[model samples]
Target: MVNQAEQIDVPCADAIMRLLERYGFDTIFSIPGVHTVDFYRTFPERGFRHVTPRHEQGAAFMAYGYAFATGRPACCMLITGPGLLNAGTGIAEAYSDSLPMLVLTASNQRAELGVGRGCLHETKSQHAVEQQIAGFSHLVLDTANVAEVLHRSISLFLTARPRPAIIEIPRDLLAAPTRVTLETASMFHPPAPAPEAAKMAADLVAGATRAIAILGGGCRRSADAVLELIERLGIIAVTTNAGKGVVPEDHPLSLGSSLPFEPVRTLLEEADVVLAIGTELGETDLLYTCKPYQIPGKLIRIDIDPHQLTMNFHPSLAILSDAGLAAKEICKHLSASVSGADRADREKIVRDSRAKLVGEWSAEAPKHKAILDVLAGSLDRDALICADSTQLAYTGNHYYPSKTAGAWLFPNGYGTLGSAMPAAIGAKIGCPSRQVVAIVGDGSFLYTLEELATAVENRVGIPIVLWNNRSYGEIKDAMNAGGIPTIGVDLYTPDFVAVARGFGCQAILVESLSQFGAELGKALSRDVPTLLQIDADGPSFAELAN
Candidate 1:
């Protein structure tokens, strides 16, 4: 393989590396298979620091975590068929949460089509799995014009509302030579401002007595704009789990996260007008379900993608614009609409929300309270936390608070299980100096338990805090709600302490509240990777709901 710096017309793999360099992707996480020979060979020449994951899924999740931490898409590569199959969960997580990522895979030659000859690692269709994920993906197939496809694919992947996209290069395409022009810059463009759209939003806020802003994934990208908008309009703001830390939770007008909480529902019901910014208000964020067209107030929605405007809830006004730019413009127009008294009232609301949250955490039982307290104390103010799906997602989003934008990352869109471990590994790799933590539930942890080895191999050293409740807590709650007994959701698992030790990382199992502080302190202070497993003392969601 020719070096990336040497401007030689080469195969699709070489061209892809050139494109990656142009996009400033210096690190790549992958689990190479026989199908990706050319990509593996070209990585070193391209000056990419490649981390070989133990599983393809681990690679994908790691890329997702890295993107969340650094606000830049990380590249992932896998072989076709089984490789792509294993990577499905990570790709889905990236898709659902709008994480920017490039997934490159090698497919069998076009000549090998449908010949029940059954080639090694062959699938019925290379692109089928991606199609299943299409609702959340921006996929592209590269059958011809590899360079052009690569350019366009990268462009779409970087656009506002960025999501995972695939470029399937066939075996023959990698072996064939092609004319290549060195790209001086990435083909992708930065999102532009939406001033006109922002003014309209400002007008809607001006006419309302009680306006509430619901921040989602898109708002995280423009935290400064959101903060400015809140300051200007003096409106109460609440974040969905994915949108946590878009603005400081401790900020006067910020209501923290509102998922799985009765207070948030009450607040929404009381508002005269609801401004949903950058979030789709999806099913999971709305407690697994919500009544359509039943919101008590006018709904004004703003998002970078037009498709998200009317989902779940109808909107009085919908605007397609970049979140940050829209927020900035709205702030600019809100100067005349907000009075001094209104600002004071908004501040009071924020105070009340904070006081309420503080009260809840303080009143929690010893075990759950210990987990929350240890996490808050151990995590650096600027450290990044990547939470997995299910109970961990709910608990972390509600209890933990982050100080900066992109500091709290999680899989919110698809609500896929088992994202925390791999994502934490990726985030650690992306920002090696910052302390990264993954909060995961037992059910979610089982989905990607093998990635623990990848973390050890790469020395990514992220502390994984497993909230071991010994059951699929969320599903149990649902079953109980429907008057069914908890059956399939409960599982007896191996001690996570032993599991972490077997994987050669520091491990601790804390069952008592008294042991919480020591275990957390040791885990966070360690130079090597650590896993702190805590046995949560509480009724399963089933018991609580029943």
Candidate 2:
């Protein structure tokens, strides 16, 4: 017979550890500080493997990368004040992108509140920082309510449209003895099906002449449903940059990414009906301009978050539901409602668009011809490519198409400049055998360049392709659109080849299309990690956009 007393007598921290273990979190990444002493001490005792990061920001990014690769949220602990503050950049990235994360921090004791008795790692306002993040909905500030808060917060973190949640542990409470409960209800809640809305969506699709489907990151969680919806409706589907791999780009219906492409912009404006699945269609996706093509035609927007349903452009029908379940329900009704004429027209459009894009790539100019060619030839079906927030992201979306599912990750929601390097590191670690590449601009590369040390030390040898434009190209593009002189946008960069070598990685520099193939091949063949710095013509966006 099992002893009931033995099962219920776990320590508070031990109980928390068991909860994490139940959730399949075996690794905890953090930078130790005075406030988090208990966490550091207890984490090891509770059988959690800890990774001590060189910097708090690096630790958070590492955790973010781990979550991205594993499709599971990772926990990060930071001390009060500076520790938490240092992690702000990466936290903002997770917040913007709806990445699942549990940010644990030590808080000043209640007894020391405003007494002017100096406290270590004290902050006047810690919660103030949490609110600054765009999608930080779940937070826990009281340690007395740790189990209750953990139960609720963990549920929210794993629920649909996952985002980062902050759990502040009081300094005194870490040592306080209390009864630890091991019982935790399952936090996973699948998005419920919306049969009625799906039927309505089907009817709307049946009536359209020219139709397009815009898939978002939320929809990517249900790639099968997205693919089924596409196959049934036979619509020309284009994903937002973040939603790139929801449907394979090689599919006839897949119109690649809709990130600031003039052709896509024109198509969206002319379409009769647009089905937006699980995407908020943020300002960045729309090139920060939503004048005429915001909602091109009859807009049918389905999202789990109700706040995302409203439109700067008009939305005809708004359905608030889970993306996957909604797509599944819509697929059920699509077969009967979709007519032969609609299917024929959609197929014809996709075929024509594919031919046009292919022809353009074949006849590309001296500048873009090389980068595109290398990407086209080297990118494997199973390879995962991560792009930073730069013109490189737009180019990758336009040119590179993944063969398998979850083969591409980008910093879309947060649009953080330095995300690709660390994210690529995480993705490589997540799938060590598969090829993982970080495509970054000079400015973005500089943001977390120090992470190269992390990569070298950890023996994570992923290829990094530097688009050496020597300028903040995205800002320059934005400035040109606004008719402003490019000030504070231009940048000076070091020789990435030398930088890569200094970090103990093989380095190559390619100036023309001719050198691309050789350099890329060499980089991939190397046993150790390599960096291929392509000093392509400045401002490729202007040429590519045209």
Candidate 3:
């Protein structure tokens, strides 16, 4: 606990860094401005690795990618209103994905707050505006309250449902000395499942004739525990897009992220019991499907957020606990009571569901699958794919075979454009040893394409596979399907290879599917970014597949 009676000469800005250091922050993404420079006074001595993004949006997205890749929050320093507002979309994306981030931004001087006196870089209410997207947005009125407010914000990121915590510091207080005693960082454990709840869930699983498991993003850290339980019970498993790679796609009982597919949805309705872990079972998870998501049988849901237990689909039994802890508890109670005699039957079910999903694919799916096949064969087993909301990525969402958890990064919830390139750069910085690739559409690629300069400046080696379809293909298709005229879907795209070279990155125009593997190989060897543009008109993936 902090004692207000004790005083110190340390500036509030420096105090923040001191506490963040104790909290284990090693990297910061920001663009320094006059209002925020006070926080940088002893930046070099503090030894925090700083990354400067071209735009504030990139800063937030970079932090998001860092957290998503490493499963830990990263810090972002922003200027007053515009900087924070520009980063709003990225922050919202993080919140939607349930990723943790610490956002520190300068607000107007205490005297000018909400005055509408036309102060420079001022907003009417930064706090209220940010509260819509962030988990909580706090404005510090007194320097004495800074430490306690920070502790409260950070605790949520660590011990509860993870989301962005916005701390708005008044510029005038940045250099002010505070007497508040800083508290040493303390760790808090996530809540575990109740003994009764665990036993009830285990009993349901043990008694089911046909049971299945659905994993969500919340299971990223609990993959091993969840896999153990799934194997122990010999049950088929499917994953949402955000939960891809929770179980290796090659596993015999795995259904390869096919939750939204018609066949998988049908199978879920047929089961006698369904175990859902760490998922909202939201409509976004069932994207492109016409049928409303339903759970007709007994549904057992395990989640950290109590409110989420009944959000979309009601559960017969709900356990409010951390995904990993609940999974372990369920496994502990299950023991060796589950017989393995039915393991072969579960494997056959997975195979049949997958085959039916393939049979129901639209004409365009096979085209994207050919390209995905090439990518799957070329990348390393531990490689991470930072994907954008494009036609190719939309297909890969259900089809990509991820080898490990946290290996596939996509804007599934927020559905933002232009996150893949900057996110790939951030992922590389966070995990320098792992291979990172960005698969983006021509339209979305333009969103953060300028981040290529950052990649080159930092000497971060990453391959950006530009899927140039010459238009907003998905939207145009949607319009056509709805009997609407396509208007703004067609775009005049630039020569990406030439633009990339102008930015000092290695660039090439991939002429055919056969040439991509060689170019990607070369890209992986360089210490800077490589742009490989595959034109939609150049060759047909359907023809290649045939």
Candidate 4:
């Protein structure tokens, strides 16, 4: 309980704490340093859980994973200068997927802020550099104004275009006694949809004879609405990498989440109307410069951010509104012009498209089945899985069927390596009831392996599955594709099993494909965290992409 007597003379940093609790943050992922140790010193007694990851980058990724696992904004506190810069990769990844986060940074005193006095943790343009990747970046120049700045920054985390927001506070203010006006945190209520845009979107999709609904990460908040619209309008649904499993893939009308794959491309080609929902049809999703995406039909899009409406393909009708509200409004106004006779044609289109894709997977069943079986056996249908950027991730993301929006956690937008382990640990902490797994490559796993210590110290058990390819497989494949010899890409990894055990996790090394499932089942069933290193020497993803 916060004491009124104590709050009467609360330091600005303590006032910030009161504001944080008011805004619904119970835990903060952070790494303490000289510049930010004062706040850490008083942190534990203030009823806040401080999770200290080994590295600043891991702490940032942990915050991202926590936010993804729980449908709330996560916070990461770091020292200024190097600490803030180290967190750039994770911040960039979260920005790409539009995840909500709060990054609290401690800067030099307000007087020496940009004077280049060579003060500890001093950097010029720290706020500017952070602003480039963050949704909003601001400085708290005064102790009295810290509460207001925190309130504003927290609110932006819940806005329609939710992403990470950075707020830098000067060290001098942290301990200074100040009277800051702190109000009860306002529940971040999103803006309502424009009535006219909703009506127009309803008219566009409700009347189409054959409509295809494409979902992206923006659709996460409206999974139910998307499902309802799909069932109501009898339209086909396909998800993007960022928006995977917004609608359960088990539905008959569902085409599994894969970007620009053959079956989904066919659906788009034949679609009389395409309802692009909550995703910016970015270059990667469209496989642009490889083969441009041309919509031959009426295109309608619903998105919270207006800028994305025409980021890539021009939409015939663009509705700037919350995805859930937009979907419900479209459903309400929709009465498909498609008749009972046209129903057969629509159903056939969905069945044939899904069947063709399944058939292709079946053709390559021998190669992928081992990995799929182990995943199926080890994790619950709704388990949360983190994917590092590597060749292995490309395949799992394309074929893996996630039942819920947050179940598949990939660095979809940033495509960064070394993200899966720390993010996986954060996901476990965020949702302790659910099983969490990190699927990573040997090359990528080495990047954040230090996080294993963080995981063990925190007693967060996340079973990690490493594709031990012993090389930067993607780069090697790219080199071979261009008819160039492999150079610096080939890697030499430490014994991962020994490394995992040394870090206090149950470790298993499986060489044969047949033993993969059994070993995984054992690891996942255990209460403690585990790591299973698989000897993978398959054809590169470049071959699979072909």
Give the candidate number with the greatest TM-score.
3
lDDT: the better of candidates 2 and 3: 3
- lDDT at position 230, candidate 2: 81
How does residue 426 of candidate 1 score in lDDT? 86
**lDDT by residue for model 3 (1-546), tens:** 333344466889998887788789999999999899999998887889999999999898889888888888889899999999999999999999999999999999999999999988989899998898899778998888888888888889867889999999999999999864545566778889998899899989888988889999999977888888887777888888889989889999899888778878888888889999989888787775545556799999999988899888889999999998998888888857456668887888888877888664556676678778888999998799999998888888888899788889999888999889888888898998889999999999998887888888889999998888889998899899999999999999998888999999999888766788788989988999999887777754445354
* Residue pairs whose backbone atoms clash in candidate 3: none
Q: Which ten residues in a row have the lowest lDDT in candidate 2?
A: 358-367
Clash totals in order: 0, 0, 0, 0
List, residue by residue over 152-271, the lDDT tens digit for candidate 4: 887776666888989888888788887855454666666556777777877766677768888988888778988888777777788887788898876777886754667777667777
Ranking by TM-score: 3, 4, 1, 2
**C-alpha TM-score for every candidate:** 0.90, 0.87, 0.97, 0.92
Which candidate's lDDT is highest?
Answer: 3
Predicted candidate 1 versus true structure: per-residue lDDT over 1-546, tens digit per residue:
123444567776777787788768888888777788887666667798888887888888889999888888788888878888888888887888888888888777877745656988788776777777533332233424766666666676556678877877777777577767664665445455466766777887887888888888888778887888877777888888788887787777778775445556667787888988888887766553342224678888888787888888889888877787677777777657478888888788767756664323322233454466667776788888888775655656666776677888767667778888888888888888888888888888888888888878787777787888788887887798899988899888788888889988988775554455667666666656788776655333222222
Which stretches of model 1 miss by more than 4 angstroms?
A: 1-7, 134-144, 187-195, 288-294, 353-366, 390-392, 537-546
RMSD of every candidate to native, in Å, equals 4.2, 4.1, 1.9, 3.6
What candidate 2 gets wrong by more than 4 Å, as runs, is 1-12, 45-47, 113-118, 134-144, 184-187, 288-296, 335-342, 354-366, 476-490, 511-515, 518-528, 537-546
| Candidate ranking (lDDT, best to worst) | 3, 4, 1, 2
Clashes of 4: 0
In order, the Cα lDDT scores of the candidates are: 0.74, 0.71, 0.87, 0.78
Better of 2 and 3 by TM-score: 3
Model 1 error, position 439 (Å): 1.6
